[model samples]
Target: MLGQAVALLCLLAGDAGGLAFANAEPAWREKERLLENNKTLPCAASGTCSLGHTRQWTGDIYPLQGLRDCLRARVYRREIILVSENRLVAGFQLYDNMMQMGYDHIVLMSTEENCKRALRAWPQVSCIWSSQVFAATPKYMLDRHAFLPRAARLGVNVLCLDSDSMFLSDIYSHLKAPPLRDMALMALKDPAIGWLNSAVVYVQNARPDGPSVYVLNEVIDRLERWAEAREYMLGRNRKDFCWEQMAMSDILMSAVIGRPIAYGCWNWDRNVTYRDAWEGAHKRYFGYNETGGIGSWHFLKETKVPWPKSLAEHAPGFRRTEGVTHQQVIQIPNTQGVWPEEFGGPLYAPVRGNKSRAWMELIKSDGMPLWADPEDPAQAAANAANRELFTYLPEWIGIAYGQDGTSGYWNPALYRGANGTGTSPYALAHFYRLFGAPMNKLTVKMANNMWNWELSHLLHPRGGVFFASTEHAPIPDVLVYSPEVENREWVSHEEWDKATKALTRLAMEMGRTVVYPAPRCNLTWLGGERNNHLPLEIPMQFKHQCIPYSPSGKGFNDNRCMLGGYLMQGCMAARWYFAGGMFPPEYDHLVVHIRDKAAEHPVATVAAEQLARSWDSEELAKTLMAQHGGLGAGLFHPKIAEKLGAAAVPAVPAAAQKPRVLIIPSVLQLTDKVGPREQLYRDHEREDFNVMSCPWIQNKPFV
Candidate 1:
């Protein structure tokens, strides 16, 4: 019986071991399953919980689940992608608005240091150190391009926003379902330049298998290649490198299909004024309509101006101004403190008039004093002192008489004999006319002779004038003139240099001076018989002594400063006057004329046609005036032409009426050894030719 019992115990033990083994099968299977799940998680390979390559967010794969949960929880769901430097003062405001809009997932992308700093300030915000993935040094537009691909790679729907912008409403509600499906990227339209403003762009990356991310990468790559090519073409040192929006446009137009979010609905540029903002605030809504409810207000460079009082309550750091009369207040340095009422004007207002002051100072320092009455004892005494100070002033007569016996043709008498009339008195009389009262006959004659001597050297073929030192260099005073020449044969580098030297010497003898070349053909009426009527209003407003001639080129009759007549200072000054530099304003347009013989060949015919059309069209006249800030009218002044008995208004050609493009040729002379000016001309030529050759305008009306 004992032996049988022991055998039964052994059998029981064997059965127990088999049961244990069967139970262990599930545990082994569970271990394998866990390993598989871990492999699929983003951190499994890196052995960390973080997600993404460049956009390394915390909380591992679980955070992604949380994101899904957050999206499911929201009525109008979307993620916010904000790219900015850590030093951006408006970031907190942007973040507050995003939070108010119910965006739980806020991804901030910036340089590593910036990301760290931002995370310290706002611990709840997810930050991405872009420099970790993007090898290039971050630039304004380039940084945004670098981060956008990373956002797309995150496999989530996101709205990319500039740090300067703020959301006023649920932006997703404005987008319809069909348009959203068709759009890979949606951006607001820039009202001024008619391009897409990437400041507030919505990128759809909802599906795992979506082509948006891939397409975005492709677009970025293409843009980079294009930029490289452009750098090679224009040289890397070119300051006006293509911005990110330009690249975005090229990509969207060429590769990806996208839609422009309505200007009022999504992008409200600076054109939406403070008044509009206040009205919108009072209404408790934002747009671009009569109701004035803007979806997003891009303050742009106007950040220095204070927010309206009604809207200031919504922004945390913004404070309402006290005892201030101005429409806006400047933001003070301290976030909590208000900008003092005494300093509560526009930040630029104080500096806006600084340029005018500089101009006034320049005029005071360099401008010649007005001539006094010849009969006055004080005037006689002053003239005597000046003559003694500048012993060479009287020698100018000797110089004209060729008493020095120089070989070159600098004599006024020689020029008079050759050109048929005595040299123009306009240049010499210009200063006296501007600053001095009426002059005696002898004094006027002296002025006329001095002007004649200068003009002889300038227009004569054999003339040579050179600057002796920096003291004799040309002053910055401008005299604007048309690029047209009376004689094309006179257009040479030698003549150009001599003419410039003549003008420079005249300025030194007189005061600070500048010469401006008007890009288009027009006339101005200096006082005399022709000054009866003023065609444009700008000269009248400025109390100008000279007014623009009619676009018809009429007042040109008996005018020695006519298109092909003798070169005169009155004509040049008229150009300056028409270009908005009326006495007090600073003259910034300093240009030297270099004639291109090849280019000039076709210009004559086209110029005549354009001039005729310009004379007839009041619209063109207003356009020209507007172009120069309401300074002067069109390429051709009709009233002047009519007054001059040259009014032959031509019918607008069918081709000329279509949206015309003005081709502004370079004033620089290009040669084998290309300088900066020549290079600029070449670049402009390339751009202009490319634009002219566009297929869309092949048959369209154009100038």
Candidate 2:
């Protein structure tokens, strides 16, 4: 067979090296055991196994000296709960609750040495860390699949949970009870997205030595394929680990085996099913009004009852909250410095406010899509037809006020218990879908809950860049990209390279991390060239230059690109790319004077021009003074970093690094504190009047 034996003995436990997974199998031993049965392995026999040959991307933030200062992973029992190493305070809160429930064997992934700082700050809860922290890549996040195959081989069940998951009753009883306990692979049936949601998955490995192990191995095998495919297309891997859910859903016979039973109330304003289901139930229970009301969710085997219809089973069930501030949301000492004592819960997203909360019974089934990404018709519509009802009902858990991180709420009762209602509701709520699914800042007056503010984990806790249309003031942010060309002028995303390289170095050297914006929006590039889809990087970052925000919502490229109303959450530095975006005053600091201030020597400039024209990328690689370079003739160039000391950037001068482009990005954001927009506005109005009045243009063309 062309395929060789794979090796993922990559145990990230805090053991021999300090970042080792405690009690986990070592690399050499793991390799030996896995290979012992390699030829007969289920995945291998099926020809789907690729873990050994496929490369896993360890992302931007992955440090070399990791785990040197980390804590050891602790496993105590057969059942293990999994959570990725969260960077926020809510993560700590979730783990604390898990421990209090008297459960050990909780596994943590993406654990960096800095986690020691966070670990010491909270109660000591020993959990196994599968991998050190890495960002924007899946290797660390997908440690679930990496660990699951091992767990199945070892005969153990795994309950993977997100840090945002809320647990009220003990997690063990609810999941391991009657209907769900027996399933081989019971993924969170989110009928909303697909057949399964990996957020709250339960893998049954009781008979791991048999057919059940096949399912576990399948997930691992599929993930390897997905990773390989994504890497090939995007030239990099995405850390979202969305492929996990897709693979879980694709298990074919699994959903029939273990259908999900959804409990907690998801986003009321955002999801259509949650909205429709919630609205129907709320109205029947307490006479439909602006504010929602409470309801019961007792088992209806003919669970023909969808959502609030579950409320019908219990008559005369008027609920009450007996004046006790829910324990589940006791405010903790502020960790992110932005949180108020009033806020509490998994995320310190405020749970209490002037308006009381409400609930509705929701069912989990892979029926159809409950919600989807906003469409052009929906976004540009004059009325809120196919949109999230964010503001109409303040009772839908205190609708978000603005993007300033205020006006936030969470219902403690819904996630935990009904607190004097009929049957206890959801034991836990995975808060992956937040209050505002798409918090559109473009239309702020009617903006849905974008969770730009308040939601600590979603929005950047520390100040950073946020892109949107102007009419404000702020510190500052940066965007590096070129506008679509109008004429058949030559184009290159590589042209934008010099600016990004120089700026990235400056930012990182300043102790600022170059963090890419969240969910990077796609942009139009190499336009008018076969309408070519040229891109600097995939998941194109943040539009057109001449008509940036045209009414059609596509700018100047007809209906090619859509960009705006997005948040940037990196406390340190932001790596934003866009097509001549108008993201100036909104962010505080605008990028000015991008052109090289240092005058280049004529000899270096002449030499660079010749080098730029050279076809050999190998030669370019050798001269790649800052970031990109592969190999070849320019290798013996003089080292500039040696002579220039502190200020010098690798030894290359700007003129040498840049091509002989006609125009350079001298200024990034046009709007600034200097306030030139007012003058420009007057100039445009005057020009418009002149164009309208000039009757000469109306006459037939006179050659």
| Number of the predicted model whose TM-score against the real structure is largest | 2
lDDT of 2 by residue, 1-703 (tens): 0011211222212123123345765455655544454444323322322223221222211122221112122333355566765543445445544433334345455454535544443213333344422222465455555455445444456676665554433445433433344445544444243233566656654443333343444454434433334434233212213355555443322211221111121122456654556455534433444534222111101122122222223212213221110001001011222322121112111231111110000100212122211122332222122211000000111112221111111121111122323322223444343221212122121111111122221223232223321112111222222232211122333333223333233222221222112111223342333222111122213221110111112212331222222221111212211111222222112222213432320101113233323222222322332322111111111332243344432233332332211111231211112112122222333333322221111121111
Instruction: Name the lDDT of candidate 2.
Output: 0.29
**TM-score to native of every candidate shown:** 0.27, 0.33
Tens digit per residue, CA lDDT, model 1, 1-703:
1121112222322322122233434433443433444344322322321111122252211123433332333213334455453432234435444443334345555555655655454444455542222212235445555445444444455666655443333334322232233344555444335344566555664322233332344334433433334434244222212445654543333221111111221122346574455445423322234564332231211122222332223222223342111111111011111222222111111121332343223222322232232224444333232210000011111112112111111223222233333221100111112211121111122212211222222222232111100121222222222344321223333354334323222221112232322111122322233222211122221222221111111222211211111122221222211111111111111111112322321111123233332121233333332332221122123432443344322223233221111222212221123222122223433333432221111122212
The per-prediction tally of clashing pairs is 30, 25
lDDT of each: 0.29, 0.29
Worst lDDT window (10 residues) for model 1? 388-397
The residue ranges of model 1 lying beyond 4 angstroms of the native Cα positions read 1-80, 132-140, 176-182, 205-211, 226-241, 256-703
Per-residue error for 402 in candidate 1, Å, reads 65
Cα TM-score of candidate 1? 0.27
